[model samples]
Target: MQINQLTRVYRYDGIDLPIPPHLADDPQGLRAYHATLYPAILNAETVDAGVIGTTHVTEYRRAVGTKG
Candidate 1:
């Protein structure tokens, strides 16, 4: 007999969803899960409206290009 230790749980608004071992180990899977579970809230119109500033990139410089 074998037993697997449980890890990772998603809790929101009194909801408790267990994360499978395989999904917990996968980074992309975890992100996809969240995106799927809360698409409406995550994709709310307010999110786009909240971004009011623009980042102007004046130059492109690779910080790691020159190693010390």
Candidate 2:
């Protein structure tokens, strides 16, 4: 899987975090990455609040010839 695009920012627990362009393609990898930072983000009081964002993914496939 490949990530075609990512939102400018992601809002989690009332905080806005800048989305890294080179995020992992797997869902679990992405979640684990966020989980590592959620603690500080949730505990911080100086972070600003913002709306949630989303990520876009794209998959490429090639057509194969088959016998008639």
Q: lDDT of each prediction vs. the true structure?
A: 0.41, 0.43
Which 10-residue window in model 1 sums to the lowest lDDT? Answer: 54-63
Q: Candidate 1 versus the native: TM-score?
A: 0.34
Clashing pairs in 1: none
Q: Write the per-residue lDDT of candidate 2 for residues 1-68, one digit (tens) a residue.
A: 87554434444554544445567345445444565777543332332233335533221112336647
Question: Residue 31, candidate 1: how far off, in angstroms?
Answer: 2.8
Q: Least accurate stretch of 10 residues (summed lDDT) in model 2?
A: 55-64
Query: Cα deviation of 6 in candidate 2 (Å)?
Result: 8.4
Tens-digit lDDT track for model 1 on 1-68? 97555334444333444456778677456545654766532432211112123321111111234445
Error of 1 at 46 (Å): 18
Number of colliding residue pairs in each model: 0, 0
